[model samples]
Target: MKKFLLSILMGCSLLEAAAQTAFTVNHGPYLQEVTQDGATIVFTTSRKAFSWVELKQHDAPEAEAVKHFNSKDGLKEAWNTFSLVRVEHLKPGTSYDYRIISKEMRSFQPYKVVYGDSIATKWHTFSTIDPQKRGGSFFITSDMHFDAAKLEKLLHAADYRTCDAFFYAGDMTSYIDKFEIPFTSFIDTSVKLFASSVPFEVVRGNHETRGNLARTYSSYFPKKNGKIYGSCLLGDVMVVMLDSGEDKAENHWVYAGLNDYDAYRTEQAEWLKELMNTKEYKKAKYRIVISHFPMVMSQQWKDEKEWVGWEDAIRKFLPVLNKGNVDLLVSGHTHRYFFHEQNVDGNNFPVLEQGESSAVRLELHGGKVQFQVIGVDGKILMEKTISKK
Candidate 1:
């Protein structure tokens, strides 16, 4: 009897050991908010663990690699399954190899912390955006609405690998109901295809604002300003991303008094007014604004009742964009494709509304800006070039 009890005890210990060894990466090691001198790397582990990123120039020796972590008040963030490490002071347009390392935390007691086995990912490569470069390309699409298969088809329709970045105008999912919704819907495929190497920029849409996890969206896609709307300079071209909150008014019955997008639009307008005065905005060879909701609607929908959000955007954002001399505005909320000429519906710049089944590849080179709308079937649906304003 004593010998049998000893064997059972030993088996239990072995199982516990095996559990600790099972800790591994669960989701991403994808790039975000990549700029000339910095980038944010985000990923998740299967279990609670402390994580960091180690990187070096692509051709540099491994000995020269440096580690980075998300730190606050001189303390590194740990004991969390989600990891977002920001790396800075990188050279512009330079290539680097990076990997994620995590050490599982077994227990946490005052003065008695226990740690488990560690794991690291194989190296991945990326290049920082260069402000001086005169040419580049990026992919833009929207209204995916949780169709992972459709997202994959759209991505495959373009030469996404050669693009500098990927932009999802919004509605990647129907709603953020669960923690895994983003991964299961679109992010996992993005990381598999090109997001690990190229930056992924997302503009929040109306659908993304629903459900419980919606409030935590920024944790997954952290920006320097902590807001969904911002601007990035890619070479001589400036891309402005605007967050056009929910489609209904703050007091609408559907919102249940939890939204204040009207005020948010006013706030964003203030920021846009200031951005237009900056030298970077004035000097860029081309300026493109991306908003998930189109500032102007077709004549038929102009009088619709639930268009408070659209009306607010036009009243607040359109004036600023007009004065900024923006060359193009790309939007996708209606899921309908149309190209509105300049001065249509009070917008000084042209508007291109991307449909649910199409993606746009925008290329900038040698003082020319051109875009081609490609359908999920890999055929060019429409093509146009914009002359400098």
Candidate 2:
């Protein structure tokens, strides 16, 4: 009888140990919107837990480290899995080693708390954007359409770690039909590539507006000011990210009476015009716009029947961009890659579009912009250097 009781006790102990080890990092520890003074790190754990980031100078002793957390709500929730921890007051152009720590919060109530074993990720290092750099490089790619295998392949091919930041222009997933797909297709792929160290700049594509989950897209990929469009200065380059809306009219039967993109775009235009007048926009030596859809559509879509909802954007945005004196525009929607140099429209900026499953790398600094497109097979499809105009 005594031996049987001991076996039961041992089994229970082993089960408890397994449960403690279950709090693993499912995805991320990916960097987002890194700036001179601050940076955002996002990640997910396998189970409900309270998470925080511990960091110090790359070469500094651990004793001098600080803990950053999304603990505004007290950090006592056991059901907190997705984490968006912002570390502020960081030195620009400096390196730091950081790790994610998750403590299983078993329970939390007014004045009462229960916690379980904790887990910490292996330490990783990241560099902040150099405030005074003469030039820096970044990677751009779009139109994944939920092709995880292709995304994983391209991440390896592009050498994402080498760039100062990474941009996904749009269509990272198809329809975003199911909320989980975006988590699986976009978030998962991004984290695996950069490991919360490289900055990521994401834009919204037409396909991202489809399906029921479309409305909840931002919950997964939150941006500055909760905006889909904004501008930031990376090194000496000013990058403006825009949301082009759906590829069809709001009244289009497919939208099913749910969309106000035209009005939304007009409002964005008003804001953009004001932004262009700001001292920051006017003073930047290099200005670039990253839109999911190209401002100048192809001749094949000239017919009214084939119109894919670009009228609102062109009519509302082109003038502002032209007046803003944007040096270049990077876009990706047509799947087929192409470059337009002041094409058919009365536009004044060049546009570079990436093919499906390809990546564009840009090295911007001084007064010159050099870029190259790499194919899925790791071949350079095109390379060019242009001066700021």
Pairs that collide in candidate 1 are none
Question: Tens digit of lDDT per residue, candidate 2, span 1-389?
Answer: 99999999999999999877676877778877777877788788877778889989998888988988775556433467777787889899899888999988788778986888688998878888785776677888899998878877777777776776778899988786764687687677777677466767789898898887788877666566887678887666778988989877778898888989998898889989888888877777788899998888777776655455677787888988988778878899889778888745777888888889688988886678888888888898988887677
lDDT of 1 by residue, 1-389 (tens): 99999999999999999887588898988899999899999999988888999999997888998998899999899889988999999999899999998999999788987999799998999999877788678799999999989888988898777787789999988889799998888889999998888878899888999998899877799988788889998888889999999887788898888998898999999999888889988889888899998878787777677687878888889888888888788999888788888887898888999889899998888777789999999999989998867
User: In model 2, which range of ten residues has the least summed lDDT?
Assistant: 70-79
Could you estimate the TM-score for every candidate? 0.93, 0.89
Off by over 4 Å in 2: 1-21, 73-78, 109-111, 177-179
Alpha-carbon runs more than 4 Å astray in model 1:
1-21
Clashes of each: 0, 3
Residue 374 accuracy (lDDT) in model 2: 87
Q: What is the lDDT of candidate 1?
A: 0.88
